[model samples]
Target: MANILEIKNLTKIYKEAQNEICVLKDVSFSVEQGKFIVFIGPSGSGKTTLLNLIAMLDKTTSGSIIFKDKDLTKIDENLAAKTRLLDMGFVFQFDALLPEFTVLENILMPAIIANKKAKTYAKYLLEKFGISHLANKFPPSLSGGEKQRAALARALINKPTILLADEPTGNLDTQRKEQIFKDFAQTAKEEGTTILMVTHDIHAANYADKCYKIEGGKVE
Candidate 1:
């Protein structure tokens, strides 16, 4: 498969009033198209920062994030936002579902933002994830696992080419976590979606096509 995303000599640094904190240093890797990639690390590791840089949510100190041959580090904020909405899906540590909206409405948020008719697709995703019965329920009324599942469905509603997940299964139990891992693996296999996930859970390595360990600001 072709390389869907490439991280070449990536570095990220933060300044805290005369103190310099380098979270990532000279990291490099590539994600193949339709492959499930997992990064594991402890807290304060650069794993989350790595995802942020790829998602263009944060600026890179120096490096080239080559996505489809374009340098993400060099893109303007407007283009970055558009790329994120149109080509990438994200599931953060928290579900981040809107409390005021019904489950179905929340799942349709991205489609609404993109102005695409995806209601039917959203329904299909809900059913696929076994959450069709909860479509009319609100986030506040759902359990942690249910909320997480809804968040996953929402992320996929746009059918993004790449899914960036940060500890996405933290809210679920072992069984649910494994189910989600299987779902991610299947998504990559059947739909050609490239998945880049960061988690503290070592079990995720079992489901990933490629796995990396990040520690002390470097990836191995």
Candidate 2:
């Protein structure tokens, strides 16, 4: 597999008053195509910040992030938005489903934003995740597990090569958490999606092809 993303000497520093809070320092790594990579660490260890930089959701204090041979750190915000919408899929800790929309509608949002029809793919994802029956149901009507499944389906609708997940199973039970990671692993295998996920759950490590432990602003 080719290198999908490469980070060299990444660093993030926040100066609060006279004290400088360094979130990340001289971090470096590479992500390959179709790999399930995980970053595990304690709170405030810069895992999320590193993910955000890789996702192009934030600027690095100092470093170079090369995605597909292009330097993301130098891209303008407009390009960043387009890159986020077309190249990356995100599954946040809260699921972030719209309350007023049904499962299928929520999943179709990215396509709609891109002015494309996604009904066929949306239906396929729902079926793939065993949530086709809930297509018309709103987020509030779904269980924690069901909502997360729907969120996963939504993330895949755009067929993003990269999926960035942050604590995706934070609100689910043990069984549900295990099931979600299993689904994620299967998705990566069959769909050729490169997943980079950050979680505090040590159990999540079992499903990853490679794991990195971040501590004290560094990756090991």
lDDT on C-alpha atoms for all candidate structures: 0.92, 0.91
Model 1 lDDT tens row, 1-220: 7998999999999989999999999999988999999999999998888999999989999989999889999999999999999899999889999999999999999999999999999999898888999999999999887888899889988999999999999878999899889989988998799999999999999999999999999998
The runs of at least 3 residues in candidate 1 whose Cα sits more than 4 Å from the true structure, single-residue gaps closed, are: none
Candidate 2 residues 18-114, lDDT tens each?
9998999998999898889889999889878888988887779998999888899999999999988988999999999999999999999998998
lDDT of 2 at 145: 94
Distance (Å) between predicted and true CA of 186, model 2?
1.0
Instruction: Return the TM-score for candidate 1, rounded to 2 decimals.
Output: 0.97
Tell me the lDDT of candidate 2. 0.91
Angstrom error of the Cα, residue 142, model 1: value is 1.5
